[model samples]
Target: MSSTELPESVAAAVDPRVSPVRVAEGETLRSVVLPGLTLAVRSRSATAEGAPPALYVHGLGGSSQNWSALMPLLADRVDGEAVDLPGFGDSPPPDDGDYSVTGHARAVIRLLDAGGRGPVHLFGNSLGGSVATCVAAARPDLVRTLTLVSPALPEIRVQRTAWPTALMAVPGMTGLLGRLSRDWTAEQRTRGILALCYGDPSLVSEEELGHAVREMERRLQLPYFWDAMTRSTRGIVNAYTLGGQHGLWRRAERVLAPTLLVYGGRDQLVAYRMARKASAAFRDSRLLTLPDAGHVAMMEYPREVARACRELIDDYDRS
Candidate 1:
């Protein structure tokens, strides 16, 4: 789709009164209001006219900015937009307070339906991966191809490192953790997150760290921050317990789109061993394993991810 093809809702929803979030160079940030949810979308200008449309979804506690490094790289190939899921980034909480995987998927469907941007090259990372999986399975007509980076699919033996995140789903745990961490500085919180998500934290530059720290400071001040995190964590935990046809793995098997699965060897949240299982689950899927990267491989190695995504689209076109 051409850049001009973006719907009026995207242009109309921009509210100057809403506090601005950090947008990368060559990217524009806007709000897209659907019925019950208002999403913050970040768009990278397409390098070529008539490029295929693509949408990106960020992981838990993440925003559209997570795709900053990668979106520009693919601008020549796709008209890319990354969404800040409801209650995260600049968006407020959903009206229904439904943070389930299905709820998130529905929000995405609404955006695509409203914009008439179906059959998009859909991309997801971690929690967004789960959300993207559901979108693909439930609405194949809305997706052309799927690219998942360290998707948070169910694991038979949950990793010990991920226990703390899962525990937030328990009632009162979020409040307790909030109280305990209230004294912590945003810099401290940012550092902790970096340690958990990055394979090598040192690779993040001082400026990037500063940006993260500022974003952390912004999120910490939001009254619903902890609630959004806790409920979304619960959503993932709940998704894992689903069985038979409702399970994420089961849904993975149902997705008709050609898939590209990217796994990070050093990811602390999702197990690296599940890469092979994901490859087997998706009927027509390719796997990209970045042994040196962590959970956010798109951020760590955007060029590689972009190359693989390009190949995924090229292969599909050839087919």
Candidate 2:
């Protein structure tokens, strides 16, 4: 395979215009239809024939675009693919209207199984992190290594700043919040999100923020934008309440793959303290804590995240 070109079959499957601006140097966007859901997958444009495969899962309210920065950085190490979970990005809602953690996990597992991409290096962020945990535990055979960035594991004392987000999952809370903030423009909403997700808002360039606003504007036009967010938010809440072997903590313990846990000290959503808990839960795990990063460390510090991932992969190769 050429370094700059995709296989004829894979090239034909990609839709170059799906997310033109978000596409990285060597990435392609394609749609994958699984048994119960259809997903928009962003993958490396070219890779060595026998390179190991790696799959990325985004958080609630985020799409495949979330991995735009990290995917290309790891392109040389693995055949990377990032999926827009059902009801997010270009993917349509599921037929059954199910958006629980298990539902999301099933969608991921099915895609991996159908594509014959199992035993992959699985990466997930925020809500995606929780879903990845379930997949790694329930079907360890499908994942070779697990990497989570600020996973939304159940917390006894939820952060005060995260309460509003958690509340959106309630039956009528989304509608209420919508009515209250209906006048806010896409730029306004994007700014608010940046504040919550970035440790230092000033670190984001104007061009990047502008692109974010444009993306937010486009998402706002989607009829199911808020629905996906609400349902997924509720799913996280429900997962937090789960007990016994099904709980996220229990699932973490069940994960057999070598794991890498990333946490941002300034993350307002997932508490930084969860990092230690997660490290302890996964038997063979390492933690990467970024004091200056917030919720989306991969975006703010892609080079750092990439270096850590490469180190993990290198260690795996040697072992």
TM-score on alpha carbons, each prediction: 0.94, 0.92
How high a TM-score does candidate 1 get?
A: 0.94
Ten residues in a row with the worst lDDT in model 2? 1-10
What are the Cα lDDT values of the candidates?
0.90, 0.86
Off by over 4 Å in 1: 1-19
Tens-digit lDDT track for model 2 on 214-235? 7787677767789999999999
Write down the RMSD of all candidates, one decimal each.
3.6, 4.3
lDDT of 1 by residue, 236-314 (tens): 9999999999999999999999999999999999999999999999999999999999999999999999999999988
